[model samples]
Target: MAEPSNSGGSIVSGVAGRYASALFELAQETGAIDAVAADLSTFEALLAESEDLRRLVGSPVFSAEEQMSAITAILAAAKIGGVAANFIKLVASKRRLFLLPAMIRGYRALVAQAKGIVSARVSVAEAPSEALLAEIRTAIAQAAGAEIDLEVKVDPALIGGLVVRVGSRMIDASLRTKLNSIRLAMKEVR
Candidate 1:
């Protein structure tokens, strides 16, 4: 049998990694990796957009049954089923819902590695237009010598410019950082 794909073994670990790896292998074996990924992306987007959902997942005050009920309704409403839905329900049953985000991230890493894609995160002062996002993705893919899975974040604190992180390398070109550097330089001139 072919070796099961791994999330680099080092990129993700602990409870989240184990769960993610198991799900990834199952999805791969069933030829449903893409479908599972799409479901997970939907779940992740929902989790990001709803404060109540965040609390339900992250808070320990909810009992296992409560979480299971809530998550089941959520999955049904979101039309997320198959292996992804089952895996999430299992997590809820085991009272591990708080680790769902990490598990999704780990799953993403595994998928990216399998597809020869590099995951990159870009933080900017404002949301980039689709054209800008495509340009940035192309540039990063060229620099990394692989297709890029770009995750964009908007942080008004950046003031201007953007910061890109691809693996261990980071390029911080934010106006905030530049001004801080200049301020430190002037302090040294005293």
Candidate 2:
């Protein structure tokens, strides 16, 4: 599969782009994009939870065969599909395991673009009701003219209100931010 040319695009073209574009094209061709995405999510979680795995992937001393064997075993144990398992082997063979995370993120963005969907990340002091979440999703979709996939997170430090982030735009309505703004205003007034 030919790598999709993301030339002059906002994809932060680099080594990560090369790998991501290649993976995206392959996934699209094989009709495995969703599976690959799910596999990458698991890989991402593993990276987050295992410092040893992170170091292992980043280690330059590990031979390609060693890396491939280890990664293949890990993915197989995790029940990842053959496509994702082989993709990891390919990355290992290229000694590019360290680039996996960036590639995963770039591939996700490409998938989102292809699906015409936007992701909204909402951080609040507490969990919002289902109705409130539905309302926010509706508002975001209306504004974006695209379907919104909401990812809700709880941050107690917010104190109250919510912080909504859609792509590069951030709506900071959290009480923490509000209090900071007021403090800055008082300092300026004084």
Model 2, poorest ten-residue lDDT window? Answer: 1-10
**Per-prediction TM-score:** 0.84, 0.84
| Displacement of the residue 160 alpha carbon in candidate 2, Å | 1.0
- lDDT by residue for model 1 over 1-190, one digit each (tens)? 3433544345667899989888989999999999999999999999999999999999999999999999999999999999999999999999999999999999998888878988899999999999999999999999999988888999999999999999889999999999999999999999
Let me know the TM-score candidate 2 reaches against the reference structure.
Answer: 0.84
Model 2: lDDT to the true structure? 0.85
lDDT (10s digit) by residue, model 2, range 86-158: 8778888899998888888888888887787788999999999999989988988998889887899999999
How far does residue 44 in candidate 2 sit from its true spot (Å)?
A: 2.3
lDDT of 1: 0.93
